[model samples]
Target: MRPTSLEGLPPTDNTEALEPQRTAPARSVVRGFMYAALGLGMMILFAGLAWSIRGGMEPPSTELETAPQTNVVSAPDPQIVSFKKGRLAYQVHCTRCHGPEGRGDGPDAMALRPPPRDFATRPWSHGETPEAIRAVIRQGIPGTAMTGWSELLSPQELDAVVDYVGTLGPLPSQNTEASDARKALLRRAGFEPVEPTIAASPLTFEGLDGRKQTLDQEQGKAILLIFWGTTCAPCMDELPSLDQVAKEFADAPLAVLPICVDEPDDELVREVARTRTKHLPLFVDRTGLARIQYDVQTLPCAVLIDPEGRQVGRLQGGKDWSSETVQTLLRTITSQATDLK
Candidate 1:
């Protein structure tokens, strides 16, 4: 018989229908929900940590930004640098023969005939201009110890050295200018008007009469100084003209001095003066002071000094010093007509 309640049910032929269905536990459901919430929280925490690290590493951002400005310093002058280079070059190559001060008194210069140029004197053997100086340095003098340096020095180096060499040259003296009228007279007389450089070298020398004489050319008195040597033939040949001029100017205010550049007691110098130079006093350099002070590179160089002790002009090589033109030159040099500005 079928029962109204399961509790009162009895055994039946189909017993599968009488079993109860299974349900999930409430504790297990609660535990699963808690685990899901924990997992979500962990994911949020990890994302926040990653963002914090990225923010710390990055640089702070600014609203406005621009490139930095810099102050630039100018470089030194190239010519100044080149000048220093040139000084070094001169010390190495030229000082051996030209002397440290360019006085032509180097130790090696003692043996060389036609001694190295004294840059202190304005007269260069070749020329005085910068271009002319460069030519001489590159091409060199044919019959002298000076050899071409084009192959040795670079173009820049050559120019630099030439500039330095100019520094060794003479400074302009008081009378640097000559009036046009005076200039014309000088040319006709074969006198190369000296671009007055240094002051007059003091005239302190020994005389042929065996006496120490310190001759000073006074202002308002004109004088001519002839630098000669007993060894030089050209200098010897000019003695007659010197004697003639000495006599010609004896009565005048001008004094013609033929200074002997030999030793104070040189027999040849004494003999030459005794036979050749009459009327003119034989003044010998006692200590070679004249050559050194006057920067006399070669013999037969005549310097004309005005009344003001200003060296007005120079005549190189031998000349007929007593000629009418020369006499006129002498007279003009002594005259007050040539007003030097």
Candidate 2:
């Protein structure tokens, strides 16, 4: 006889024991729904964040400009003195002007007057000997853009860089009498010595005097043919200094001719040339071919020519012609021209 009333049955404990089983599935279902809601909230939050970040941003570009990559020389034999450290230092300090391959074709090469040395080919201005190179590394070229690295680099690094520069050039030979004579004309700057000095190209240009002439017309006098552009800041800075030089040497044997590489009709160039370089003869390379003929790849570059119309050497960069060294050099050139007569 089972009792029917609630809490009356002794066997009710058996049903109570099975109650958890009955509720377990429902708790699992509730948990699944809660997990789905949490996942959906996370997805919505991430999508909104992405949208905000992408707004007002530039479209990704496929035609981006690529910069030069560091091309460190390969590993060398351990027996030899390692230039690895020097190369690393060069990349840090010198590559802006000296270039990755030490070719002097660095990105800043064109902008710098006395453009960086073309270690791969051309002669150096100051000196190219290891001792000389080392000294320059330590002391720097005075009044020029080259600065000393003694403070920034250690002696070991200096020595290593010198060695590295040593490997870059077969500096113009200084052995023969002809070589010596050729170098003599370069007394003004690191004018590249021409072994068999070449004839000056008959560059035809328009002058401020409204006369059209060829470079050969100035053949009888020693020449300072300067190539400049209106855009180069250094060229503008060099104008007054060059003007003073031209006036000071007016009666001298040298004929200072500043030639503009800009278009003949460029009004800005014309105005600047007339006012800034008043003392010098004005000429504009109208054909746009003079630079190719002169091999002038940089601005404020000049070619020193003998009265015979032969190119002695070229000077690259703006300069203070009034400086003692430059004046001395100019005087020497004048004296030599007088002797040539």
Candidate 3:
């Protein structure tokens, strides 16, 4: 017998009892939708806030500009006894100004007054003996950019530089008369055993646009002339920083000329100009005329020429043009030019 409600008239349907269960699932779905919407709203709000903060910030004027100052360490007894060690040391410290081959015609050699000493030449003024060369490296020549490296390099490193230098030229011979005569000649020429200034010669090259450009045309403006070549590994390394510098001073009255010393065809030159450099004006010295004019003996060098057509500064090897020191130097040059006008 089926059970019937005690007080009601009709029997209730069993489905009616399941109605709350169905409604409960619906409520749960609604809550889940609400939670999703709230999460999405929070994400949007954070994104907007971040965008606003970013917009309010200023663009940085410099990038990785400052380098930490290093403390000077006294050199220990030289442990670099091998020629290989000396060669490596020379490459690290002397390659920029002295050149990789110790030719004394490093890229920056042209800008230095009296120029660097040609290791291959006879009669080294500082003496060809390893000890003499080491002394010069430790003491540095007066009135020149060659600062004493005693504080910067270890004794082993100094020995290495000396050893490397000796390999480039003949060592001091028993005959002292020739060396003495060479020294006397240098003194007579007012070099004081070392010249104080080297004049920068004018250079001419074909621009990417087929325009014939000469250093003389840039006399009225300060010139930042970069001598580089494809064969030079160091020169290739410096290109990116050089491009940054070119862009930085685009508006200034300074001519940034990056002359390639490679002998490439017009199409190749155009390709290199378009791809390698960032729209920086490119020039080619196919005949090596420009290199000869500047007396560039090394790869990857820069010359800062004043309006008077005088080379005021020079940098050799790979340089960080983005550095604060480099920027300050450029600014100072610009300011001086303005004052003169």
Best by lDDT: 1
Q: Using lDDT as the measure, what is the rank order of every candidate, best first?
A: 1, 2, 3
| Model 3, C-alpha of 87: deviation from truth (Å) | 35
Model 3 pairs in collision: 86-160, 107-298, 113-197, 113-198, 114-197
The per-prediction CA RMSD against the true structure, in angstroms, equals 30.2, 19.0, 19.5
TM-score of each: 0.46, 0.46, 0.42
Residues 66-157 of candidate 2 have per-residue lDDT tens digits of: 54433222232321333556666788888899888677788888899877776766556677788988988888887667899889887777
Candidate 3, lDDT over the whole model: 0.67
Distance from true location, Cα of 211 in model 2, Å: 1.3
Best by TM-score: 1
Candidate 1 residue pairs that clash: none
Q: Which stretches of candidate 2 lie over 4 Å from their true place?
A: 1-188
lDDT of 3 at 161: 68
lDDT of 3 by residue, 23-101 (tens): 9999999999999999999999999999889867956435533544232222221332244567677777777887876
Q: In order, what lDDT does every prediction score?
A: 0.73, 0.72, 0.67
